[model samples]
Target: MTGETAPVAARDEADPVAVIEVQAAVLTRNFELLRRRSGFDSQLDRAGYLLLLALDSLGPSDIGTLAAALGLDPSTVGRQVAAAEGKGLVTRNPDPQDRRRSVVTASPDGLARMAELSVARQRRTTKMLAGWSVEDLAQLARMFTRYNEEVAHHYFTGIDQVGCAAPHDQPKHSTAEDDS
Candidate 1:
């Protein structure tokens, strides 16, 4: 459902679980839209763009390194690199240190296209957050960074140990008469 029409449970804004759920939904939808706009729906799939970006940032890297940087499987990154190579957006070269492994890097054309896309994306993001005050933007950045770090820590450790209890296990904080 669209955010405007979605039914929200009657819960206080201070309720951590409810706030997290709503924010997660909002961020997921926004990221999906951003992904489509950033060429995921076109010739460059999300994997390709991400792979190219990683290559651009990290220079030539083997499949395993790229996969680890992008939090993807090596096989998946290999496929993405192959597809990007087919599109002339990236090139694979023999790793100097490892004869059996290949290192991937963004091609000149890919670099140029990536620069153009980055500018466009920056413009889009600026426009999207034009209504927000500087403080709000800063707060969002800080909060998002903290949230991501927490998620990553939990993922690396055990999420079950992070106290992400099931919904049914949560204490009932809402009263029937308070349904909004």
Candidate 2:
């Protein structure tokens, strides 16, 4: 029964809050499935994932720039980079313009692996929204994206200002937190 689908279970009687809670649980379970399939958890711990994500979005960046982008200390990001390099997921090379400075790049293999994982992640998302119409899905995406951006800008910036700097740019995006 490796590929067998599970039977659908009925939901209990629910108030609005209870319905929301059940939806949250279902979303969380779907997310966990995506993570497991992606193998991101096994490949890179939280720090490594952040580093890879930063590199993927920003391209080759100096340690200081990466640290600033992540709102983390340079030394901490340096250590994370070292770990990524050791796994052949990233490489740190001397900046051509400034030989003293270094730029980090995600390795080709790393990019390929990430792409595969991304596809698997997308499949999970599609399954989650299977019943939604295209317009509804589009609207949901827009609203969620805007909400996330606002929360990150407001809360994360405030945390940084108050000196609660973490190595990751934003805390891991949890379904519960996002829904809340």
Considering only N, C-alpha and C atoms within 3 Å, which residue pairs clash in candidate 2?
none
Quick one: best TM-score, which candidate? 1
Q: Write the residue-wise lDDT of candidate 1 on 1-180 in tens digits.
A: 455545454366788878777778777987997787566346466566667777777788888777666655689888888989998999999999978999888999887777776677778888989999999988987787677545544332211221221112222344666434
Residue 43, candidate 1: how far off, in angstroms? 6.0
Predicted candidate 2 versus true structure: per-residue lDDT over 1-180, tens digit per residue: 798556434365446656655665676786777677666777556577677777777788999878766667799999999988898989989999999999899998777766666666678779977999999998987766665454555445212221223344544445766655
Q: Point out the worst 10-residue segment of candidate 2 by lDDT.
A: 157-166
User: Which one is best on lDDT?
Assistant: 2
Error of model 2, residue 172, in angstroms: 20
State every prediction's TM-score relative to the real structure.
0.72, 0.61
Measured with C-alpha atoms, the lDDT of residue 170 in candidate 2 is 48
